[model samples]
Target: MSGVPMSGAPAQPDPYAAPDPYAQPDPYGAPMSAPGGQPMSPGVASAPPYGQPMAGAPGQPGYPQDPYAQQQQWAGPVIPPTQGGGSKAWIWGALAGVVVVALMVGVVLYVTGGDDETPVADSSATPSEEVDPSTEPSEEAPDTELVTDPATGLSFAPMPEPWRDSTANYGVIGFYEVTGQVLDVLTFEDGSGWIATFVVGEINPSQLGSSSMTTDDAINALADLVDGAHYSKPPDFTEPLDGLERNEVEVNPLTVGSYSGSAMSYHLSWDDDSIEETGESIALGVLDMGDGRTAGFFLSLPDSVPDEHLDQMLEALDSLTFV
Candidate 1:
């Protein structure tokens, strides 16, 4: 009975052997069975173990219902971090470009300043044409004006335009030609019936300190000298010859344009040969300019002439100047 084997004895499995085929497959490979021997229905996906991607489960169509199952395949390629050294280099390069642009602008401004002489003509405006000098109206020279004699240091106002300079030498006196004079007298004529005579002469030095002639007498003598030289008719010295009557003014020392002198005035009346038949022919002003010198001026205006002309002559006499 010992060698033959006892019926119904329990046996232990070998330690290093493969699993029996009838036993259930490993737990990790498939779903576990239910208590009644029916397989369990699929369960919800659990959180993945740490540090692993969720690929899929082991069953039919693995993880078909999981939302993130194919997320890794769908994502675009990863971009490396653009944080420290390369980023700073790009910023510095941009700053350098801006500084270079600023320097160029400064150079341009310095070369062309705000006050440069370039004329800024308006493009929309019409330009004006240049004018010719010959076509412009010119000013005409005056007819009656002042005349200066440099040699004699004299300036005569209201001198006639038609009068000329004389070549005749009058012995220590300056002479000017007059168109209206038939005698060799220095006469001036205004076309409107006015005549003036001017005489300037150096005096004898002896005549200054001890002259026998009184001032009034000397002035009268100058008048007489002019009359005798111009109108000496030879019948009676002062009679019906023009029937002239004379009135004299007191003579006094005066200063006329830098020259110390004596001055006198005279009024004359005549019957016939009077100026413009007005019974008076002339008015005279005489100066004995003293550094041994003298000047005599005579003016005659027809009554037909406007009184303004006579006034002008008188004004000219007042404004005499010696250079």
Candidate 2:
């Protein structure tokens, strides 16, 4: 129908009337304005293109070819960006919340895991209790049967039927021995009870041997020796031994009869077990080696074990031959 000519002129219908989805102007590069933009009559300027509302048209809307369909405070089909952005905002907020939760978890793990101040560490702390000089040795005598060689002062309690006595040990410091061999009635110098094994070693009182010293100094010196630094008597962490503490260790001239040699006296106690949230200051006496300088070995056992009965240890130390 677009090619049909006008009845009056018999002229060809406008070839451009068939709407080109692309081209708009009449064979011209000018932007197409509106369909009714031209005059109603051939030479009369009546109204603007369909886009502009005629002054007298009273709210007549724009035409089909208008670039913008509706124009006012708002326009048509106002599709917002990405579902109105509210849902997107919620989604992003959830994602952010997850990230925050993850970060919080990470921080909690980092802060809580593997701190230096652990209960195990506190549990393992060495203990020191004051030696109760008042205690007397028990009437019980040494279990000489446990003695392997009385001549050499070397001994171990008699092993049970399947166990053996005086087994030679291998590897590491002052002879460390664990009785894989079945044994019972283990006894030491004090005859208090059977110990798993006896660790015999020596301490080398630093070049500064027995000089004038306070009891505290002696304790510090003792603490240092047990720390495996027999050659260097380092100062102890000068804090009171609360509960059970590995207090001080040191080499001192403990004269018993005519014998005077370097002895490592470890100050240990079961004070902590007796008190709540703390330990007592008590000593568990472990005597000196036959002839050597030592600070001492100390361990804090929570419970008491005839620790006050240290006469045997004192006797043994006193009996040691310094030569």
Candidate 3:
């Protein structure tokens, strides 16, 4: 019981046992002996306790020496850590691929020269088709009834209804003392005795009974004729009629059709006579018909006549159109 070992306990060593030939040779050389006179295997060396250095390790006394320890440290290139994800070489490869694609796109744009863009049109350029002035529609004048003067061949629009050409019944020769040929006579049918007379004659001073050197003088002479005939009693009159009181005369420039002229307007009153106190309104116009010929118009209206009649007569004068 003293020498036999129990189960799970370490076996005791035999002093007379022989060494096995197949065992591995010791690495540190021959075997060593303990202080108690026991033989020890060379493969088994005494190791120091935990937290202490081994007795026979390097840098310690009696440590075994290595022949090639002093030649050099490793001195190789450093390798970066490949711990997290993909390596840095793969990232650099991807960046180079992107730069190459960008350069290729730039080259394509330069070669095509941006041909997809549209060109701007010039605003000041003329159109291809020209418009013909004759083909375009023109504004037409208003429609009106027109009458032509037999003497001057000039045309005009006569006054509206109830007014007629009373030339046959009216005495055109003795109407005015001017030495000219009478052209036309117009009057109202209402027997108001109002009349409009037109005349054409030479610009001779002796014939018009004035210093008619210019057309303006002729116009003034025509105005003077109306003033002499109606504004005062004539020296040749047989009946003793009251001379009409005259208002201030107004002279203004007038344009009728293509003729330019002057017009004289005034009002006359006969207070003592059988005629109404609000007597009459008179207007006279003289236009230079050119080529030494002048045309004259005289309109006389009693105050009893409607104002519309006067307006109609004036409109008739404006409607003159020279042939």
RMSD of each: 69.7, 47.0, 70.5
lDDT of 2 by residue, 205-300 (tens): 221133233323433443432222111111221222234334333333332222222233332322222122211111211223333222222211
lDDT of candidate model 3 versus the reference = 0.34
Residue 32 of model 2 has an lDDT of: 26
| Whole-model lDDT values for every prediction | 0.29, 0.24, 0.34
> For model 1, how does the per-residue alpha-carbon lDDT over 119-177 read when each residue is reduced to its tens digit?
88899999878779788779867755444444334444543434233222211101111
Better of 2 and 3 by TM-score: 3
Q: Rank the candidates by TM-score, best first.
A: 3, 1, 2
Candidate 3, 1-323: lDDT as tens digits: 01111112113432222343332222222221211212221111221110011122221111122232111100000111234533223322222232223323433544465577797768898766877989987987777755554434445566666654433212111122121111112112322122223332222222244332444555555444333322322222212226545554555554444555555555554443332233444555555555434455544444344446545654555444444
Candidate 2: 10-residue stretch with minimal lDDT? 71-80
Query: What's the ranking of the predictions by lDDT, best on top?
Result: 3, 1, 2
lDDT of 2: 0.24
TM-score of each: 0.37, 0.24, 0.42
Prediction 1 global C-alpha lDDT: 0.29
Candidates 1 and 3: which is better by lDDT? 3
User: What number of clashing residue pairs does each candidate have, in the order they appear?
Assistant: 0, 22, 0
TM-score result, candidate 2:
0.24
